[model samples]
Target: MFAGIEEVDWASMKHAYGPADDVPALLRGLASADPAERERALDGMYGAVHHQGDVYPCTLACIPFLFELVADPWVPDRGDIVELLTSIGGIDLGSDDEDEIDEDEAEGAANYAMAAAAVSAGAGVFFGLLADEDPGVRLSAPLALAALHDDPARVLALLRARLAAERDEEVRLALVEAAGRLALRHRPLAGPVADWFARLVGDPGPPGLRLAALAQLARCAPHALPGDVVPVVTGLLGQLRTSAAGPGSTRARPVEPPGQGAEAAPLTLRGQLRALSAEETAGRAAPWTADLLRTLHAGLDDRVAERVALLADQLRSPDPWQRVDAVRMSDRLIGGRRGSYAELVRLVGEQLAAPEPRLAESAAQLLAGLSGLAAPAADALAERVAADPADWVRTWPDGRTRLGSAATALARLGDPRVLPALTAALGHPLVPSELGPGVARLGEAALPLAGALRQRLSEAVLDERAYDRVGPVLVALAALRAGAAAPEVLRVLRGAPDAGGERLRTAALRALAAFGPAAGCAVPELRALVRRTGTVEAAEAAGALWAV
Candidate 1:
């Protein structure tokens, strides 16, 4: 259909592709057995012509011709059409009158000029195609509009208008894409642009679409997401927290209620803005730092450690919005130099016993930073960590990557109190990450106890207690030697009963295989364990058997 000037009767073809006249060609392309022929006809008509007025009736003619192809059932690609319109509209296609025109011709020329001027004039014709009955045409239209619509205000207006009237999910999504592009351009638009986004952020149409809209809003105005939108992000944070809590099955509820204003709004517009501002200032000191500090210190006294303790307990709240703000404030209060390190340590120490795993993890990280500044808090933090239950230390409830940050923090503090918990946690499924750092901290302080831990495993081969207790000890022992426990490692493997002993004993043997000749004495038993557990574990052992 779009055969360029040489392939068609340019004068007659002008109206042939117009909406009122298009029929036979569109029907032929739609019914073609060869999909490529249909695709070629569509792409050629939509993509081949660039300078619409250079060889035909003024740019005014492109309005109908382009719309015809745009409305065609076989016009599967909007991007191609967008490129076509963008190329022709971006250049001077020349005036409608060829020479000095009569007064009557001047009106025709003025009508063409009005239709051709403004980026929107070209886009208006394309946007009109969005109203076509065909879904393909509807989907393609906004994309062309997004590509060609240069007037940000008009584009935003068209989007809101379409959004209110649009019933098709696919077209609604196209509107989302259009809005995102406009937002990205950062152009001044109709007042409703922000409101439209705020509405979507508050009640995202679908999960994927909601997240995409939230991310775009965050990118555009990290600190100024409308107050109504905060609940959506806070809701996601709650989902993550609940999943972290434990594996018990509680029936899930709809993420948001069907009606508007159904949940307590998490933050006011000001609070949402401040949170984003703090995030933006993560690496730099914010101007609001002094103000933030004064506000936090308003009712509390510096001399009162109990007041600090109460503040730390707030970290354990079930309300995710509060929890998030609490963590951010803690990072500011404790990490900011305006506060004493002693205060920070005191605050974190109090929070460790708090029931919430997410809060406890935060306290652990804060304590880790404080360890280098004050040694007294180190032992205190270690004691509390060591006293915690083994399972509690095993995995974090939130989607956190590490559960025993407190143990790691304690290790960094050079306190031996954390050794028991660290050693106990070593064989658990998620224990490997905390192992290296903890052992490195244990250093020379752990040598005397290392032998005892090794002997416990050696003495208790037939006992379940030993099976449960020894794997972490083995990991700790190997780590302390800087990979020197091969001989002792081999002896344990030879002695432990496969039926009564646990998977940790086998894992211990494999750990030795990693050090090779550094672990040469354990080579034979490791090979046997490999035969038992198969090549994967055996291979790790095999590599360690010879030092390479």
Candidate 2:
């Protein structure tokens, strides 16, 4: 179908990388009979060519070939190809309006402007895909055309008409979201579209359609929505608040930050901000209720206090999902400045003692993160640490990702009660996270756990499997400036090379040498290690010698 695939001067055009020469090779790999090969090709192409919606010239040129591939009947995983086109065309939905972006985001605003301009140039390809025969292709069309076109009457009529005949619930959801996104771009038609969404929302039809319409209203034309919108959304959230996962469920509640997941590529700081939206939660396979709650909160921006009140209600909900949604919402509302809204902080503080274990766990994690915010909840966290240990489900690890653990939270709250809990957790066989960092976050407050941390440090010397925990443990000791533990640090420095790998040895050296000249005893070993070490360990070893 691609007539000149080989003849295209892809080398002249730039993609995410410096040259677009690799683009054709990856695209050809997409046609491989092996499923794994095709998946890898798609992933590599996505990361390099259309990373975080930054559309390079090579990306634009590849659009027609993608369309041809999607239309090919014998193509393996046609659905995925169609989805890729939809993602590519999503650059079309990007807005160039500078006012919508933060003033500090000169780069973000500029990136969006470039992507939108480039994608909008190829508007005709998306508009024509509206009547594609495949169900997946048909569903993707409206979203692709959304912000790419400004003709309110034309796009709305097309989407609204498509929705009437659309039988698939998933496709119907996409259509409504697309219509809302389009309305956001074109304000002239927002009032009518808002009226349409409000009607769809209140209709006693399929719950999914109603929920989709509600989410769309939250995105665009929120002002034009009906007066009874709140009740309609509230009722939907109640329906979706079932405490347990549904049938055909793995029951795994993945806590990911939008598209900032580990899958596509490592995101730059600005890419993270640009990817934030209701789409992450709303379109997920489960937790539709959380999605609605987040969307409702997004549309109710007219009053911050009111938004907090709504979230506070969820925080107190008996249903675990509602409470989880509340935690997620609070993270968005009162970020670092927990003092800005003392009332919100106080109300949130109450959740640290919530009867529901998950709610209390997430709340503890939230307060632990904010400097001094946890102080208001110190007493409550103390109560948590005093209680018998419960089985807590860990969503993710602590570093490079936002993870939650009651033990981690208590450790960071700086309450003396955390000392005993940290001691017990260190002995537990299945502890959620390394207790050391949370102890380190407590800084000098962690002195009580010094003995336990040392015990674990000694265990690391005996157990090879315990070596990974060595770094965080050393960090805690260094933070305490526990000169008394210098002997243990020296042991790790001596044993790490023979017992553990390069990483363990480096961490041990860092811990022993982090303090001042009190560590002079280790100076000889530090100098010898510096000579044999790779770049990273050499840096650590040099610092250790300087400390001595």
Candidate 3:
């Protein structure tokens, strides 16, 4: 079946690395006995061939081989190969949603469809995998079918049938979602598909499953939904509170098992590929309601304001799980649209001062993500950061994360009054995650704080946390063209973690390079870095020296 692999002019084809000569070896590596080697080969293939999902022409060239690989049960990570084929074949295009929506064509939808044609042309394998003995393979089959530009509806019946036969909860969840996306894109199937989802919502084994169905139902057929939206949401929230609080997995790194949210083992390949982001993946080890919470928020199209209000109420719920879900909803509701919610911002902003440490921290983080849309709550966020307990400096659980969250929110608000607080935060030995980015957002406008930033660079401690403090400040200072920072940055880079770790070294070198010839004083240390290590840091150091 792979005879064609050698027949092609492989040398001439371009992958991410400019030539496809290495493609055949990587493909063979998929079946390697060594898991580590196979993992490396897979990573290499994705990086060089798909290259952050920019499918090259050579990507299409490998389609037939992938189809063959997916059909062979002997191939390890066969589900991953199927998913790879699906991603290569599928385009992220706008739904066939006829509703007046202000949405764009899925980013690179055209390129995606064009790349996916190679796999769709071999649609027979995908359709066959829907009933494969391995549940992992079966899960990916429907997703692959969803990529079908031409016979999308052809897989609808197959998915529904599999959903009934499928005993594994994760596989069933993917099938239902695939069905929803297909129904949305292939408008003709909406009525029947919507009815299927509606049926699942009321008659359910688990509340998460039902909530997932309702979310999809609302999305694919908003007008077809029943009148009692709020009550259904209320029940789902109750179920979530129960789920999240139930004895979560005790493992250091937990992977949720199929059908059960209470505990997790190590994740399967199928588990990692789903829509939820990596950050959301960890919570799964806990009895996670995050997926449903995210889906419900994402699915609400009609009565959106009412749903948002309901979500806000739940954010203030006494149950920790309900509150966690609500906090997540606040971030999701904004969805980058300034016009979407006035009340959401107000409520979440107020939550920034909530007595519960978790709620206040989550609220601050959410506000930072909302940017200028969260401007109205800037005053409250600023006050919270200002009122950070004096004892927080040494014993804070996350060092400066909580304080930084509030300061970051103020920076995003683009309010000038945020400068004093931000400058103080930046000068602290433990800077918060993304606080430097918030500072960078202020750009050259932060030039006024250049003197203090330089002083902080010189005086800051070089503890493990020092990297976070100095790295972002270095980047921000460079962005602000604070050439005066070169000397202090040079000192930190030559020093150890006790002076600031590799993070500061890397950032300082990059900052020096940003200064061009203005960083002349650091030439000796930069040359030594190139000579001693010759790693990525070496390259950065060499570049800095050249610029100097």
**What C-alpha lDDT values do all the predictions have?**
0.51, 0.64, 0.70
lDDT of 3 by residue, 453-515 (tens): 788788877767767667677877777766778889887786647332767678888888888
Q: Which stretches of candidate 2 lie over 4 Å from their true place?
A: 11-22, 29-34, 73-83, 86-134, 225-230, 241-286, 316-319, 336-361, 375-380, 387-408, 411-414, 422-548
User: Of models 1 and 2, which has the larger lDDT?
Assistant: 2
Rank order (by TM-score, best first): 3, 2, 1
Q: For each candidate, give its TM-score against the true structure.
A: 0.35, 0.62, 0.62
lDDT for residue 179 in candidate 2, whole number 0-100: 82
Candidate 1 wrongly placed segments (more than 4 Å): 1-151, 155-183, 186-320, 325-350, 353-357, 365-380, 390-392, 395-403, 423-437, 457-475, 478-487, 490-548
* Best candidate, lDDT: 3
True lDDT of residue 378, candidate 1: 68
Candidate 2 residue pairs that clash: none
Over 1-548, each residue of candidate 2 has an lDDT whose tens digit, in order, gives 67898888898977666788988877877776655556567766777887766666677677777767765656665556656665665543344565665764655445445545655555556555566655556666677777565465787898888888877655677788888877777787788888898888778776667877877787776665566655565565555555233312211211222233446533433234324532333333344556556776677665566566667666656665567667868877777223255556556667767666656667777776665555666666666656745522232343222223555555665555666555655554333344656676777777877887777777664356445456667777777777777777878877755544666676677677767687777888888878976677788888888887
Model 1 clash pairs?
244-397, 513-544, 516-544, 516-545, 516-546, 516-547, 517-546, 517-547
Q: In angstroms, how far off is 353's CA in candidate 3?
A: 6.9
